[model samples]
Target: MDEVAGAIADPVRREILVLLRDSRLSAGEIAGRFEISRPAVSRHLRVLRECGLVRDEVVGRQRFYLLDPAPLADLAGWLGALLRPSGWEHHLDALETEVHRTRRERRADRREENTA
Candidate 1:
């Protein structure tokens, strides 16, 4: 999971994943889409391949890469669990909101009292 997380932390790698999501592309084909050097893109592809985010196959002279989202399942579940709010969190948020509202009301009352 850590390796997958670190692999996708790079914007270039993430973009490569997006490109692969549609269809497999040869290394040269993928490199051509980027302004960076082919070697740089290859490095990013290597990272993705190592992390299991992508799988590559050799066909004749070209090596094609495609997305492999299986590793992302665990990461997605972990993120979902983290983002889910606990019951106490909801209560605490309501309490904090009420406290702020009370303070605002007291201030308004004080201003009115002073004017009167």
Candidate 2:
């Protein structure tokens, strides 16, 4: 996970992953999409590859890169557990609403007592 975080920490690397998400692209093709040098793009690809976020294939002389979804799926699974609504959330919300309602009722009673 730390490796994945480090790989995605760079904006350029994140963009590279986005480019590779839908289609495989050669390094030259990726480098062309950015203003940065091909060497720079290669470095980003290396980080992504090392972290298992991307995979590369050498077809003839050209090296193609594509997104590897397994790591992202693992990330999603972790996040889903954290984000899924717990049954207690509804009860907590109801409790909060009841507390506010009780406060309002007390204030109204105090106002009526003062007037009387």
Candidate 3:
């Protein structure tokens, strides 16, 4: 759990995981999406790999990264177990949904204000 926690502690690594959740990507491709250097991205990938959140395979000369969701499931299970206090999960879910809806409404209001 230490590795999983460590891997998820970084926002950049989380974004990388989200990207790889859809499909595999090369180190260069991942680096291209950020302002950080290639070596920095490589280091982030290394941490992710060590945590078992991601797996890298060397095909020819390039390294490609793939997401491993099993660790995520483990993490979620642990968190769920820890947060089972008086049905807090449902409250949290409702809070999240409301926050997202509020954000969408704010964006729409901003767009309308801008257009007028």
Candidate 4:
């Protein structure tokens, strides 16, 4: 997962991932979209493959890279936890404190009325 995160940290690599998301593309096609040299693009692809974020297949002498979302799914699940309510445990604790405060105030009010 560390490798996956590191591989996607680059904007160029992220774009490459997006490019391969819906369709498989040869190394050349991927390089054509960027102004960088083919070797640089190839390096990015190699990192992505090593991270298990993408898979390459040799199709008719052409290496086609395809996105494999399994590794990303782990990251997504981790990020999803951050956005979820369970992530906001402190907020829930605050709400619970407020509820208890309100209940104590109500109880005190009733006791004063009964005493009067």
Candidate topping TM-score: 1
lDDT of 3 by residue, 1-114 (tens): 878988899999999999999999999999999999989999999999988899999999988999998888878988988877566777998899999999999999999999
Locate the minimum summed-lDDT window of 10 residues in model 2: 69-78
Shift in Å, residue 98, candidate 1 = 23
TM-score for predicted model 4 compared with the true structure: 0.73
- What local distance difference test score does each model get? 0.95, 0.90, 0.92, 0.93
What is candidate 4's local distance difference test score?
0.93
The clash numbers for all candidates, in the given order, read 0, 0, 0, 0
TM-score of 1: 0.74
TM-score of every candidate: 0.74, 0.71, 0.70, 0.73
Candidate 1, run of 10 with poorest lDDT: 82-91
What is the full ranking by TM-score, best candidate first?
Answer: 1, 4, 2, 3
Off by over 4 Å in 2: 90-116
What's the best-to-worst order under lDDT? 1, 4, 3, 2
**Whole-model lDDT, model 2:** 0.90
- RMSD (Cα, Å) of model 3: 11.8
**Predicted candidate 1 versus true structure: per-residue lDDT over 8-106, tens digit per residue:** 999999999999999999999899999999999999999999999999999988899999999999999999999977989979999999999999999
- Model 4, position 84, has a per-residue lDDT of 72
